[model samples]
Target: MSTLLLRLAAPMQSWGISSKFNRRTTNMEPTRSGVIGMLAAAMGMSREDSLDVFNPLRFGVRIDQPGTMNRDFQVVYQNPDDILPTWLTYRYYLEDAVFLAGLEGPSGFLAELEAALMHPVYPLALGRRSCPPAEPLVLGIRDVDLLTALRQEEWQASSWYQRKAKWQNITSLEIVRDASPDESGYAVRDVPESFSQKRRLYRFRNVIREQVFLDQLVSSENTENEQGTPKEHDPMELLEDDDVSIKSQNQ
Candidate 1:
């Protein structure tokens, strides 16, 4: 089997499994249904199209950079006639997160997907329309099984994160993978049943959470700040500043 790799990095991403009307939630990692939907969109498939072709492919995700989770409060007008009544909603997202996603399947099918991702017929989003992915989404194809590719591939965290790690003198990374029925795994209701917006559906899949260490680290010396200068000595300071800004806006 051949595995197709994708770099899922964005400023904000949301992978909702059982999100309801007032409270939209997100998983710590990418979901299988979300990834398959992205692929279908890249292939120019309609929401009503059959997803059987992609269902057989084994899927997995590696948490290279588990960014911070943030929540946004929104007010939706319940009645346009009277703006006094509003619906309060809370949406959750992963900020500055990076994930390594893999799909193992027939070589020809995966090759087709790789081509489509490189030159997609439709714009691709991480999990929601507002969450547009960064460039270089297609990481290329690997000649390995799903789990093997997920475990062997190098860390795919963002450059800024790599620099932060180096400044902190940190090493190693962790990853998670989809598991078979026979293996020790947890069941998640993320498998796709139908992509139809009017009648959304989903099933369950087994996932194995594993923590692997990566001694090999990518050089972050070339990483530069916004002004093209070397990054600050303390990355947490910058992170704190961001937090303050976000909190002020929310207030």
Candidate 2:
């Protein structure tokens, strides 16, 4: 059992889980669906073949560092009509996406999987259209136990990381990377350049549901919460118990 860590930082990234038309895009949290889509794209899997690899993923996520929770707009289209003014709108969501998983079986298959992710043939959307990744996303793969420990520690310390965690029956584990300098340099806080051709600029709107889901995904990787009954205290906690300490003064 190994885990994969991925770096998804990009200059122009958007992960829209639930967005509607007229470019009224709402950035949604990076969902299992969205992440899997990214994997499929990297692997060049056709729509028909994507689910075979995506549907049964045992999943967990830890957001080690959260990016600026900001939103920006992109002008999709515009028209001038005194009778009816309209603009195409799109929403962008920026949430640090992380994932961990155990493989289905066979260590030999890792190379194939990594190759697929490293050079995906399809267009990878982190979670939204407006938030397309800026460059090559980063990924790290390792064993489940080690990954779990690291993930748990990350979760314990941050409110942002404690969100966006999800549970799935993982068949395998693969992390995506942003290796392109231009693409990776983009951040969520960036505002797209305005187009002179457009008659209007549509402002992207933020939705709370996206935030909640993003948080849910990161917060879901809880090994302690899943099965283990809470031990009375951590070993360090026990040492701090002033009443339980026996001073060793054997000088």
RMSD of each: 8.1, 16.9
lDDT (C-alpha, whole model) for all candidates: 0.82, 0.40
Which residues of candidate 2, in runs, are more than 4 Å off? 23-29, 48-50, 74-85, 88-90, 95-110, 123-125, 128-136, 145-251
- Candidate 1 lDDT, 1-251, residue by residue in tens: 99999989888999999999899999988999999989899999998988899888999888888999999989988776775688899999999888889999999999999999988888899888999888558878999898777777766776678779879876666667778778978889998978998998888888888776655423334322222532223336557746557778889
Candidate 1: where are CA atoms >4 Å away? 80-84, 166-170, 216-251
- Backbone clashes in model 1, listed as residue pairs: none
Positional deviation of residue 186's Cα in model 1 after best superposition, in angstroms: 0.8
> After TM-score superposition, what is the CA distance of residue 192 in candidate 1 from its true location, in Å?
0.5
> Scored by Cα lDDT, where does model 1 land?
0.82
- Tens-digit lDDT track of model 2 for 166-219: 233222222222212233322232111221234212222111110112332334
TM-score of each: 0.82, 0.47
By summed lDDT, which 10 consecutive residues of candidate 2 come out lowest?
Answer: 204-213
